[model samples]
Target chain A: MPKIVNHEERKRKVAEACWRVIQKKGIEQATVREIAKEAKMSVGSMRHYFSSQKDLFIFSMQLVMDHVHERIKKLPLSGPPIKDAMQVLSQVLPIDAERRLEMEVWFLFTSKALNDPDLKKKSDEMDDELYQACRLIIEHLTVAADWKQETERLYALVDGLAVHAIMRPGRLHPDLLLSVLENHLKVIGQNV
Target chain B: MPKIVNHEERKRKVAEACWRVIQKKGIEQATVREIAKEAKMSVGSMRHYFSSQKDLFIFSMQLVMDHVHERIKKLPLSGPPIKDAMQVLSQVLPIDAERRLEMEVWFLFTSKALNDPDLKKKSDEMDDELYQACRLIIEHLTVAADWKQETERLYALVDGLAVHAIMRPGRLHPDLLLSVLENHLKVIGQNV
Candidate 1:
């Protein structure tokens, strides 16, 4: 029996190429021709999946968020809630090659999204997810402190690390990021 | 008296247009035509100050940095070191309309700078200024700790606030950011 091609998977392959194009040449150059070239597909083939560059960009940005959510979902749920939470949030930081690219593309796309309403809507959705994630961690800590303040602080630190890691990689190495994160969590009542 | 046109002031007028363009239309659309229209100047007049779009962008970005640095420098210096430092660093966070637009354009322009060499060099210099400014704050603390780690954490928090304020303006309000900064500075040995 012949199997049908997975359309979502095919689209994701093209999105990955979009990331590479954005990474190598900046988002401005993530044109249909460049992305198709990077994806090693003819523009005709790409048109089958994405009718326009805008469509591909939207799909690619959504893919970036989906990947983060998927990774967080697959994380092993163990240890104290705070510890598990740190693990989940660390996915946002550029701790490795893959995560690093995720971060670079995120910054690139977010900047583009700032003035694009369609992309801004998607960006806002991702920001909401991150804000909620921060709130979840603070709630799990069993602290009497205001969750809103702590959430802002925690999220800021996370965002800051993600940015500094990409901008000043030598300074905010993964090890430093972990220590800073752990200390912040501890202050909020983590045992260790 | 026939006063000669002040070239610097004229260039700044053009740069202001650059900010408006980046803020209203996003950085990618900040072309010569768009900026000229925004500045309400003839394209020929705009070209006299910035021969190329690249030069205009670099100058505009530098102007953003200079504006921030100037604001911080003008802040009162006679206070407890921690309190004074907080005031200085808070300039980077978007606490008002002017700062808000400054930050939005900064992010948009910095994203464009990521892939361009001349812009990247200037961007790196600005990053260094921020890192050094963080160090200056840590050094001003009363108690001695590992300045490097403390500097990194503090800077991350500050950066985080600036970014979060833009990305989630509803949540990380200026008051909350001020309180958080005050609390973080206290942890690092602010007596008051």
Candidate 2:
């Protein structure tokens, strides 16, 4: 009997390989050949899944967003309010090497989107998703205070925290990042 | 008599032209030829100032950091502390087209620095400069109770504000950005 491989799963594996190449050696190095080599497949096979370079690029970025969504879905949501909120937010930060790679690729794709129109659409959608998450966190806290003001403050802080984690991981230690986040929760008078 | 052109000034102008090209077009479009065209000179003349493409790229990036430093230096320090801090900090944010261009180019250069060893040295130096500025601001607030902690908080907030202003200009409006910065300074126990 021959081993069976899922086409969709193999496509995802190729995208993941592209991401690793991008994280380790800028996006410029994420050529079809390199990604194919990393995936342990031939360039011809990779091209069978992706018709063009743009297709692979977009799919790779979409795969990144999907991974983030998957991780967020896995977090234990049924917990104490404060702890749960922190956990949900921490899923977005680079607390571990995997998330760090995800963010590195995220940042690279974002810049690349500036030049590629198709990628720009997906990038915009992801931005909205992030803002929506922030809005949800704000609304949850607004039961105690002004939704408008608290929403603005919380969103800024969350955005700040995420970017700091990516830019200066050493200075913005995850524990310290969590403490400041917890402080904001207290300031907003959230029951958490 | 032939016009006496300042060699150093001409080189800076060429670097600035290179930045405009990179920010408007993608970095890949920022070729020596395009930069020369943007600067209204022949490629050979531009070469008189820069020996290679790499030199132009490095100088253009350094020019951005230098410009940011010059702007910060020009800000008047003898004013209401809150107002002065706001003024200085706002200079770093993408409030207008010029600074937006600067932010875009700064981000591009940062990504390039991750893989380019030569650029890495300059990036590390600038990173320290950014960190030192935060440290200085914290030290200045030492008269306040728990100023050490206050500094850390404000530093994170500023970093967050800077990134937000660049990544989501429309979402994080200039006024709101300034308001958050002001409120943060207040929390630092600064009297202004």
Candidate 3:
């Protein structure tokens, strides 16, 4: 049998290579050649998947979002509502080594997006979706509450927790993260 | 009287020049030559204040922390505890253009500090101080409560709010930031 080529899978391999390069070196050095080397492929092969660094970055950045959404979709919603909610929220925090890396890369990409228009547009749209997700969770659990204010507060809390947990994981311990989140739910008197 | 040449004041002026360069161009472009041009000083004169970009960045970064501390120190703390706390917290958020610019510069400098040992040490210390400030406010507002956890939550909330408000001021809105802070205070049941 002849060897089969999987274009989608190959492109994803390239994107993962991009992530590894970004992790090992800083974003400043995430050049196409370096990424190709990281992926263990020729620069010519990388050109087939991504013509430019911007295209590669957009795909890699999008991969981060897709990964997050995939986890959310796989969440066990059959558990107790508050527990399920906490579990869902914890998925977004850097509670483990793998998550911490993703969060770090996310921040770097977001910062880079500050100067790149296409990335900025995508970042803004993604943030709006996250804000909406925050609002929906609050709506499901709270009654007679100011959903708007709560959404802002919860969004900020999650964002802040992710940042500290990613940057100072030693201090912002994972168990501590869960408990603080649970405490927030208790404080808000979220319905069980 | 001889013209009084204030070395300390002049150094700050140079730091501010660095900020303008960072803001106008970026942290990467904030070279000594560019900063000197921005400061309207000759490169030879600029060398007198900062031996290298590292020295200049350390000073510039410290100046940002000092500015925040100075503002917090000047806050009127005699009002109701929650209101007073919100006021103190508000100083950290970017409600206006100037503070927003400061926050952007702070993020860039902090990111740059990640690979630089001296800046990393200083960044960690500054972050610890800020975390301590968060603990103090939580302790002040509540009696016999879990100040440690609340401090983490509050710190995260404030930091998250500031990042969003600075980056997406048009959407986050100044009033929304205030109300979100107020809502967090109310959730903790600071006062009736």
Candidate 4:
């Protein structure tokens, strides 16, 4: 009997390959054939997962968002409120290799979103999710930061850190980035 | 007398035209001919100012940095420190039409900096200038903030606000953005 291949799993694998292609080469280089080769599968096999290059690009773009959601969802949160919150939130920035890849892919998709309506719609949803998460964190902390103000600042800080990490990785280290968040939260009445 | 344009002034005008072309179209659409047309000069005349499209792009990228420097220098710092500091920083974001145009062109050039060596050099220089300015602001504030941490965080916040303002103009208003920065700064040490 032949081994059974998990259809969804294979699709995700191909999408991941597409992300790598976009990272190494520009997004335009992420054609179906190139993605298939990167995934170590035949072009026909990859087509079985994605109907066309557009389908593949959309899938890969969705994959980046899904990966972020997955990381945030699975983030281990326990212990003191400030420390746990900081640890969980830190996952969003490009402090390590994995998050760096996600950040690179995110920026690429964001630029593409400017022109692609479908991508723009999805991108808006992600932004809202980020905003909501910040609101929740600020509310949960002992800090009495003004809800509206803190929410905007938190979202902006996340974006700022990600951009710096991508452009000036050597300068903005993980510890330094964490220290900023920690001190800011502490000032607002929370101890990180 | 026929207007005999200075070489340096003509070059600056051509580069400014390039920025307008980028703002109107995507960077890929900003061709030498298109920029020349926007500048209302012959392609030959434009070439005399900028040797090639790459040269034009590099000069345009630097022109933005120069504008930012000029704006920062011009911001009135004679008033209350906190209010004046906020005012100075606000120039960097998309708070007004002029700054909005600058922010838009800055982002467009940023993406190109990834692949273009000439643009990358100027981008790095601008990044350094930004970091230095943020450091100076943190130093001048005489706040209780951990200098290294607060500088990084505030810098990130400014950059983040700029991105949000450009990308989600309707959602993130300029007033709200400034309020957030004010509240965040106040928490650190600034006061009425």
TM-score of the A chain in candidate 2? 0.86
DockQ of 3: 0.53
In CAPRI terms, model 2 is classed as: acceptable
Q: Please tell me what DockQ candidate 4 reaches.
A: 0.49
* lDDT string, candidate 2, A63-178, tens digits: 88888889889887877666677877776677788878887788788877776678878888887887677667767655744454455566667766766666667777777777
Which is better, 1 or 2, measured by TM-score?
1
Per-candidate iRMS values, in order, are 2.9, 3.9, 3.0, 3.3
Candidate 1 lDDT at A142 equals: 51
- Model 4 spans > 4 angstroms off: A1-7, A28-54, A142-145, A190-192, B1-6, B33-37, B40-48, B143-145, B190-192
In order, what are the TM-scores of chain A for the candidates? 0.92, 0.86, 0.92, 0.88
**Which candidate wins on DockQ?**
1
Per model, kept true contacts as a fraction are: 0.75, 0.36, 0.59, 0.65
By the lDDT metric, which is better: model 2 or model 3?
A: 3
Assign candidate 3 its CAPRI class.
medium
Q: What is the lDDT of residue B12 in candidate 3?
A: 97
Order the candidates by lDDT, highest first: 1, 3, 4, 2
Candidate 2: residue A59 Cα off by (Å): 1.3
Off by over 4 Å in 1: A1-4, A190-192, B1-3, B142-144, B190-192
> Per-residue CA lDDT of candidate 4, range B47-121, in tens?
877778888888888888889888878877877657777877877888998888888888877766765567878
In order, the Cα lDDT scores of the candidates are 0.85, 0.76, 0.80, 0.78
Chain A vs. native, model 3, TM-score = 0.92
